[model samples]
Target: MSNLAPSLTAARQLADEYPNHKVTLLLLTDFQLFDADINRVLTDIATFPGDVHAVVLGGTQVDGLMDERVQITKATYTDPPGTVARAIFASLVNHRPGARPI
Candidate 1:
C-alpha cells in the first residue's frame, strides 16, 4: 500500500465510499528500506493526496542485502504488522492539527 499514486488513489476511493471509516497510509523510512531512496520517498510523501504518516526506524539488513536478513530472521521494527496497527490506532486517537497529508 506504499506505492504512492496507486495507494492514494485506492485509499481515496475507499474513503469516499466509506466516509464513516478512517483511512490512513503508513510509510516506513529507514536507516532505509532495501531500495531506500530518501529523495524518492520524500517526494512520494510530499506529492501524496491522501492521509499518510511515516515511521523512520532502523531497517534490518546485513551487508546491504535483503536475502541475508531474511535468512537470519532479523526483524524490522515495523514488521509483524501489529506494530503498524498500534501506530494507526494511536494516530486516529490523537491526531495533531495540520499533520495529515493534503
Candidate 2:
C-alpha cells in the first residue's frame, strides 16, 4: 500500500499487544504516498519505540524522515525488492549488528 499511516497504526497496535517483545515495521512505497497528513505520520513514526524503516521510491527525501528509525530509498523498477533488502540490511549492519528480524 502507498500510505504508511495504516501500516504504522497496525505496527503500533502490534507493539501494544506484545509489550514484552520487539515490534518492527518495514514499509516499501512510492514517495509522498501518505493518505494522511505527513506531519501526523512523522509524529507517529518518531514517537514509535519499535523499529520502523521505509524504502520509498522516487522523490526528494523528507527533511525529518531519515532519522535512526527510518530509511527511505528511491527504488527502481528493475530491483525494488533488492533495494529494500539492501536498505534493511544496511540499517541492521550499521545500527544493530547481530540482530535478527522478528
Query: Which candidate leads in lDDT?
Result: 2
**lDDT (Cα, tens digit) per residue for candidate 1, span 1-102:** 233445445655666787665555555534343334545544554544446555434543334332221112223655775665566555565445556522
Q: What's the lDDT for residue 44 in model 2?
A: 84
Q: What TM-score does candidate 2 reach?
A: 0.65
Provide backbone clash counts, one per model.
0, 0
Local lDDT at 55 for model 2: 65
TM-score to true structure, per model: 0.36, 0.65
Instruction: Looking at model 1, report the run of 10 residues with the lowest lDDT sum.
Output: 65-74
Candidate models: Cα lDDT each:
0.47, 0.67
Report the lDDT tens digits of candidate 2 across residue range 26-84. Answer: 66666565475877877887778667666676654655655665655566666745666
Q: After superposition, how far is residue 24 of candidate 1 from its true place, in Å?
A: 2.2
Q: How far is candidate 2 from the true structure (C-alpha RMSD, Å)?
A: 4.2
